[model samples]
Target: MDHDNILETNGLNHWFGAGEVRKQALFDINLTLKRGSFTVLMGPSGSGKTTVLTLVGCLRAVQEGSVTLLDRQLNGATEAELVALRRRLGFIFQAHNLHESLTATQNVMMGLQVHRGVSDAKAQTAARHALDLVGLSDRVSYLPANLSGGQKQRVAVARALVGNPALVLADEPTAALDKDSAAEVVDLLKRMGAERGTTTLLVTHDNRILDRADCILTLEDGRIVRVDDRH
Candidate 1:
């Protein structure tokens, strides 16, 4: 693992089932994500893009080899340690996953609630700041139903960023938006990366936003086949 990398995977392999019926989702995956860099992982459906995102987010346990975040080994981390590690990594899924019942501010505040002793006032302050950073300050009180697709996604991003995470993982963030809205979200992400010094890894099939990525990686058949760095 590279000492300067925010994320590193070595001989990583994930499989389902056993014997002849076994299926491999990722195989011999070795990669590193530099600190404060914006990287995109692009691939067709079922190409292990989401699998890699999930593994990095600590949503899935490593079945083989090693995975590390901020130099801490993830494959051997305890449940409590995994929770702590996840708190330092923000994740945005294809679905905005916002609580329909909660307002945008409340939804963003949810992330801070996971911290051991964050006060309500402090959480609200952080949530407000996050929403403002995403250009959603005016929609803080709006529920998901009242917001546009882009707004909902922005709220999700705010929720993710509210924790002040060291790394941000986004899965198909712009897939549900129109071209203008998608570009807006991409710009927001880029600006966030630059302003906060957060390492961002975005997984997407959306070709339109690829140009905004500092580094682009292509995965196929559960393997990373290409990497292009424009910066």
Candidate 2:
């Protein structure tokens, strides 16, 4: 029951496959993400960075050890429980994943639709506010097909944050953007963390954004090898 931490993993180990062909993926991984803090996970490919992210993000089931997210333990949690927990998280992937048929506001409204009681009008209001926060207020009615690469990513960011999720999990979110766009997206995420108290755990290989992280964790061969805490 650590109230200050939004995520905690203790002795976390993961394996792929079963029987004689089984292979271990993650070691005894242990980490903690404090509320409103921004953390970056960086490592070489196949070093278990994404594995850790997926586990803590509730996209994958925990095989061994404990993973506590938002004051609830993930180990042995039912599918229904996991689904409920996932609604509280915001996820941003490398791909923008916008529906071509939808406008920016409509796309963002999709994020809030997962909740039980939000109406379309209210969702649209929240989505517009989120787009405004991400500097996309003018593009609310624009379709994703008409937007630039960076603008599409901004729409993705707005979609993720519209729900007011407690934690935001990003996997290479800036990979597809240009230099300036990447910086802008990262800066927007940092501002959101500062202003909204949204905790973020991002997995990135882009070194340009490392300087902005409050804590940077480096993994190697499925083990956490370095932790650089700027704060």
Q: Which pairs clash inside model 1?
A: none
- Whole-model alpha-carbon lDDT for candidate 2: 0.94
Choose the strongest candidate by TM-score.
2
Q: lDDT of all the models against the reference? A: 0.89, 0.94
Query: lDDT value for candidate 1?
Result: 0.89
TM-score of each: 0.96, 0.98
Q: Which 10 residues in a row give candidate 2 its minimum summed lDDT?
A: 188-197
Tens digits of per-residue lDDT for model 1, 1-231: 666689988899999789999999898888888887889999889999989998888888888988989888989788888888988988887799999999999999998877878999999999999999989889989999999998999898899889988899999999999998899888887887788878899999999998899999999999989989888
- Tell me how far the alpha carbon of residue 60 in candidate 1 is from the true structure, in angstroms, after superposition: 1.3
Report backbone clashes per prediction: 0, 0
